[model samples]
Target chain A: MSAKLNATNTLRVTRIASVKTENQTTKTYTFKDARCAKAKPGQFLMLWIPQIDEIPLSIMNTEGNSVSVTVKAVGDATRHLHNMKQGETIGVRGPFGNHFTQNNGNVLLVGGGTGTAPLLFLAKQLATKTKRLSFIIGAKTKNELLFLNQLDPLCTEQPVAATEDGTYGLKCLATQPLETLLAEEGKEKFKMVYACGPEAMTRQVFNLTEKHGVQMEASLERLMRCGIGLCGSCMIGKYRVCKDGPVFNSQQLREVKDELGISKLGFDGNRIPL
Target chain B: MNSNPLSTRLAGLELRNPTALASGILGYSPESLQRIAEAGAGAVVTKSVGLTPRVGYPNPTVVQANCGIINAMGLPNPGIAEYASEIRYAKTVLTVPFIVSVYGYSAEEYAAVAKAAATAGADAVELNVSCPHVKETGSEIGQNPKLLTQVIRQVKAATSKPVIVKLSPNVTDIVEIAQAASAAGADALTAVNTVRAIAIDAETALPILSNTRGGLSGPAVKPIALRCVYDIYEKVKTPIIGCGGITTWKDAVEFILAGASAVQIGTALAQKNPAVFQTINRGITAYLKKKKYRSIKEIVGKAQRN
Candidate 1:
């Protein structure tokens, strides 16, 4: 159960143990990896799809000897991964970067799209520790709002849903309801606010956390070539998202305010506006 | 009477120590460079920048090997034009020397990138002609004495700052190439780059790295790199910056004794944190004290004398 096995920085081939469809563009692939299975929520693994490409994916859940990563078919590697069969094999390297700090008391989980995958894993772990856990899951439509059924039993209150097309609960962006949530709960009510989604949404959540003086931890995604921090593709300010973070606290977030949601390094190492 | 045992000069640029942050390792931006500088690297070299932006190769770019790490990053860069600002910003906060690593397909391109680097306020420009995986440039230009000479001369003429040529170890005769670079006016030479190597996944029956081939670095290449430094120092007059597989103070000392004026740290950073710089510097200082050497310069080529 030592996560150190996943931290070898070398490729280890593992066959897919199971696969679950999450949404239209996203699918959850489970593979048996003792090292990966022990990974703390918020940590990620670099999933290598043979000759196609090697990309970083969030650890969605770990049960028994298996670990799962929820991947959306957004790029070449992920698309290829979606087409992979249950018996197909892929290379993995990690459980890398830092993980979220589990805080007690009232906590809010905000997720957008496949970003909900990691949060769902976290919610399951935090269910027994926290006094109250509330989730705000957002997507373009009800079909895309992920992990609602999985989150139901774990959350003290029913998980809130927000869809842009009004096909679900709140007809607005994920962060739109955050202000009301933070205000209703009062500034001191929620001990920590954890979020993982698009940069824009994370940025809004960050701003809200700052305004309300609530502690926040967020997972950020970037073009990562080397999960060991050698490559500079995932850099934000001085922090390499692969090493210094994939999850960053409020203090660390403040240091990278300039590039957090504003810009990111592209595949060619050019800074592109987010 | 050098008051600091660790202080040394390489190609006319003053450094706090001899340990440098090698190119292609956390040197993509001014902030990362500044962070390493703050961590106590005597000098910092940026990831190689070219005339045009290059996305390099796809993933599976790096893998851990038996004794070292193999990488085929394909020379991904933001291009010198876009990276100039990063150099400019680094100059403002960095207290140590800042070297820009430049690469290109032709001599003219190398010169252009060096010129852009010079204009951007770089203290020196390290010619990255030794990268093994990329074609047309890197080892392609470095392996040939004539081509290497052309690159050195053009880059030397393009920039007033020191031009340090990084040589490929995969050559018929490294000494001849080092001599050629020296004759063409290279101010200093980085003795070696990653040795060309490959890793294959038995499960998939395919090469692990996207490029199929890559440059090997880390503890595995130290002996190879030390030999290059030792050989190049015997024939070349230019200062030698020993690179490849230098992880500890003992390793750094070995390079100095073999005639290296400085050493570059790359793969070691992957294993240890940036604090490795301070650790090495401390070890070097202690070694100097224990040996009763007044300055690290006295140890240069000490083994050669025997």
Candidate 2:
């Protein structure tokens, strides 16, 4: 609501390191924007070309202003955005929204599809701060799984990967490993939980963390136009998914209505309507 | 992007710059307007108000798909009496002039609201001649060039301050309406209101919007908005407040070059991160500084070297 705080006020192109495909529809952009390296967790920025439209992208991690955005070639803007190369200078607008809070105890991280990008950045932060951390990630099939191999080195135990097809880790759902880990380690093992993915899965992750009385924060997605509150396109329940969220802790999600497939979690930790 | 002072007279009101917040987005509440305008917008257009208070449509009132949004707000607004109070309230906060936007089914209604807005200390009155919700056959007063002329002229006659005529983009020929409006005493033109459209529920088999049809705006509609502004600017002498799908300063510059004296931000304002006028103005200033262009007037409509 305040004037846009520029996390990337002064930035220029670092270079496109490489591009990796995550599914027929999504691609991971590994580029360097010197401005993005200064961004904090939960903050996002606007990436755009001069003539093309501007679009908001959550900064994945910055190795000195050299940032990356994992994009899905869904439409003309993104399709064209993905085809660009390393040397091109795309404009950066933010490092916007609230950042994930830091905790020094045991933690759990989960994600699905390209939603992993933000959590991956959070994981990188957790890697240095937390005593023990575990991750659970999922994809529709093996091909959709991204960054898990990279995530392995950052955690105590490798991320428990899941795919709908038995092509990855548990061959069940990503939540399965969390419940197993909880049962074995006891509910009090982790002090906090962080997750991002589809509404259905984020809701499930919320329920589990809530039962353990563990604090959890999530990155939720909505149809956003302005990436600011003025457009009113990305409202969910009473809050603006663009302004108020895109990231919400368990306590914040409780205030939101469940209509958009995100009612409170069922007792067993599954999204009810879905 | 010329910086030689882009401020111009809209209905004789001096806009610090050429952009204004389009009607239907910013409400009469000064707090919201102040939050946005502080970012360096040219002006803020209060949401369209009328003789009677309107509650507007139900929730899910806004949604996004691909590059744009479909909104069927039904011009929900507080009646003039309450609206005037809010305008007075906002005036205390905003440094820029607050342009009042009002709509009605008939000429008398427009004039009455225009009078109320003037009494409320509104800087100017923008007569909304193009809301597509009138009767379905055509806009009640806006589509017919003669009726448009009559309505705008009456509104102008009613208000001492300048009167701007807002036109819909759905017409087979938009320029005709712009020309007619210009000739009828309109002081400025706000080109290209929403293009009427509808969404359907594949599951329930009903129109998605409660009002049955809504106006579409966003990145998808910029070209159409630009074309309308370009066409209207050439046909009329009135200043133009170009709107629709304008999210960046580059888009703003295009509207100016296409002959818009100023532009308004609609759906783009709803999202939180608008490097909008501040970023855009800076970008414009930089472009001007870089090119040694003297003023915005210098390059308006001067196409790039293709």
Candidate 3:
């Protein structure tokens, strides 16, 4: 029962732009739909896999009538999504919840692992606005890091890169470049910061932003059922992250303790309920 | 929306629409009554109430299946005495009529809940002779026409308000049970309750639900409910309140065409969208206007059989 929205139509896959196998367990899928105009950067879609259950995925790219989703085959639905081709049909609903907004300010965009997809979308949107964009991408190793080819085209300044081992740009973490960027500009040149990644990395981002006093927003992850605020499964503390937020302004999280986005978010920052 | 132009009054009560929410699914619990009534649902049914407080089963009163669901909530309630207060509170809050679903194991247990429901200002009472998992009662009383009629007559005798007997779906012939309920002066009949089912842990080979067996509801059981309603509509002279897996307005319209004036939606509220009331309401309004029917009355039981 919906407001005349057919689950089939509301959750249809109109176009599959590209199918890239990034790793053994993960793949990048680009889809375009007229209904995707409602989506924003931090908001997600509930990808319905028919007999299997639905899973939540952040929209990685949004252009004229299309949105892209990068899925990791960790579960049933995600596994099914990884197997689809460029012209296949899938069930997708929403572009649900609030988005990460960028005001007319200098921005620092940070990303990690496959969590880089949303940042890639955000970076292109930010680059068109102003050239003073700081982009940092990181992974555990050279191979584990993804989306380099996509990011190379979008970043005005060279995209900052790092890993735990000395296989890429820096040997520490993505936050290291951000810390250096803060030091070089007397920590005041960047007016805003945003990030999507593992909770640990996001926690570091939120902490650094708190220290720098920059306006910051971080995308959080939580397992969602009805994705529209009915099944009480995707709860983070008090708020239903699906309805209240998946992207929260860093300052607002000061009052929120151990929310689902920061606590239970799995790889790529989607909440996976066990 | 009476299907038969030649309608008979039950115990002197007239039913314009017989589709009512089964007791546990849509209850007059605080703000919920006003919400459901506003949703344009035909009517509201209160959760089952007994003589004392019951905690019911925990954690897994409900389980999911490929088609529907199975739930074994052990008639959890705040008992008749406390429920009377809740019923009073509900009446003041609800704009539409409220039906109280009362359950019991013995003759006096049933009578007590009925008396409490009457005094609490409920518009009517549905004698719940069937709940699959609750031991010592429920379907045991429902499947037997003798017990079914007796329960209806006793509850009807206890209150001046309309009395409806809710029958079990897990029965040989639901029509016989419906006729018996009608003959006993029941004002209406609620066609069915959830069928009993259980799930296993697979690895452990142990029952999954705490109650071992639960009542099935949702889109999965829509067919069974449809069949039950169609079967009973053929024999019952009294109004029939059709329930079971009614989550959409399309489902509601189907029940109406099959000879029910209204419907009750459950399980859908849990797994699909909680904004179910709005969806069902919009669909009903759209269908009504599109079909050019002045009222639900014009199209009820309009299905033609070959």
Candidate 4:
């Protein structure tokens, strides 16, 4: 492994280069680090806020030697991260875990909540390789839908949005339109379907893709401590979310079907319903 | 006939090879253990399970230093009650010996977890009285020979399966503890858990691991671990399972020569993946052929003899 890859296990200190407010609860922080900058879409970084806590965030974007992580102020670590200003130093460990496989042909992207972070990065990367690209984002409200402006320019088809309260393009769950899209487009029309969201949403999308016999890959979230494969916190069935994948394909999902959306490991390592 | 030169026996359990997966490294679930077993480990050990559920410390729990990795995971587990099902599942799929590493705050708790592990179908139980970072349980108990002996005796009485005690390198005299464990009915001993250590960040001026102090594992601790194995081997009749910083077949062979009946691999798994088992096994097999030894048993403690 190169030094950059080896740095995945070693923590590197970097100052926040820039910050962008994505929504009321979410902000994207950019930092100058070669190891993280080299991250492929669907991989994540373990960000450490000194004296506070370390949390895993999806790689939102990368520009040159700079990489960005989108954070939603859900827990203590993220709330602290939200209050920090630019130039504040934090520790980074990865660009760890596997990334989504980019394939040629028409593709569909489904994202919900902060899960859209990695999918947005994937969408941007897939723009050039795919002949036709479509994006679907869902959130509790219109303001919560992420990266509308950025995704619009790259998508070959008009992006779709679903708000639980019907405050946006569609008043249904993100998977609703995805079901229609996959049904109308037919399995042969779309080469692959990619999803990153709440486990339930991704699991729903997986079922849809399976019903249609289309290949799918979805990024999952679990209580993670060691971003490397060592910790079993991220284990889902036979796979460790940190190593085997934060992103898993159709076959991988099938193997973990019983636990995919129904249950996940809590911080205590006990199986708790998702 | 079992003619493989690498085959060895530890505590009456037959192992296809001398390499067993050390506890606390991807041994959480049955599937992960099965994955390691399929990758060619002679035996697989589970992460240390306690009497109750423990969330462990927060992130910054593990970091890679210049020579090795340091971690203070705070003994995370789903509790033995929940983990028993995983053990039951592991027994169904695993072809190699499955050992459950158990820990507790007291002798009764350790015995309780060991009994549960036995009921869950574990081939053996490795007492984890040696975790360096945890307070009041791990090294705290292991550092005291009296306490360590009490814990071992309780666990040994609770289960019929072979009991292996993992020793702490942080102690003043490992041989005393080794002897204590052997006297208390420990069938085997894993000489040396990670050396107690820590890392600090220059920029923040704070410890990198959430717990201020952790244990060090990798190539840096190999010499120290080998010394412990050698020292304990001289005084104790119990079989020794050498662990700490074993990265190559040479390292495994050195531990064997130093009197380790078998070896455990942990930190190296982070760098090498599961293939390290096959790599080390192959190297040991080649070395045995070159040295004209018919089996690994013949070479155990060869260096000690000299």
Candidate 3 lDDT over A168-264, as tens digits, reads: 7789999888887766754447777888888778878887777867778888776554455433334454345676678888656775555423455
Candidate 1 residue B147 C-alpha distance from true site, Å? 0.9
| Full-model lDDT for every candidate | 0.90, 0.71, 0.69, 0.90
Residue A156, model 4, lDDT: 93
Candidate 1 per-residue lDDT, tens place, B1-306, comes to 669988999899998899999999985788999999999999999899999999989988998887688899999998888888888888998899999999999999999999999998999999999999998999999999999999999998888999999999999899999999999999999989999999999998999999999999988899999999999888788999999888899999999999999999988876677889999999999999999998999999899954
Q: What is candidate 1's TM-score for chain A?
A: 0.96
Q: Which stretches of candidate 2 lie above 4 Å from their native place?
A: A1-274, B1-4, B134-138, B271-274, B303-306
Superior candidate under TM-score, 1 versus 2: 1
Each prediction's RMSD to truth: 1.9, 13.1, 10.7, 1.7
Interface RMSD of 2: 14.4
Q: In angstroms, what RMSD does candidate 2 have relative to the true structure?
A: 13.1
Q: All candidates' TM-scores?
A: 0.97, 0.57, 0.55, 0.97
Candidate 4 C-alpha lDDT tens digits along B36-75: 9888899999899999999899878988876777888999
- What's the residue-level lDDT of A129 in candidate 2? 89
Q: For candidate 4, report its TM-score.
A: 0.97
Docking class of 2: incorrect
Model 3: residues with Cα > 4 Å off, grouped in runs: A1-274, B1-20, B26-28, B272-274, B304-306
lDDT of 1 by residue, A1-274 (tens): 0123224676889998888887788898989888878889999999989999999999999998889998899877788888899999899987788899898889999999999999999999999999989999999998999989999999998888999999999999988888888888433489999999989999999999999888999999988998987877898999989988899999999999998889998888899999
lDDT of 3 at A45: 78
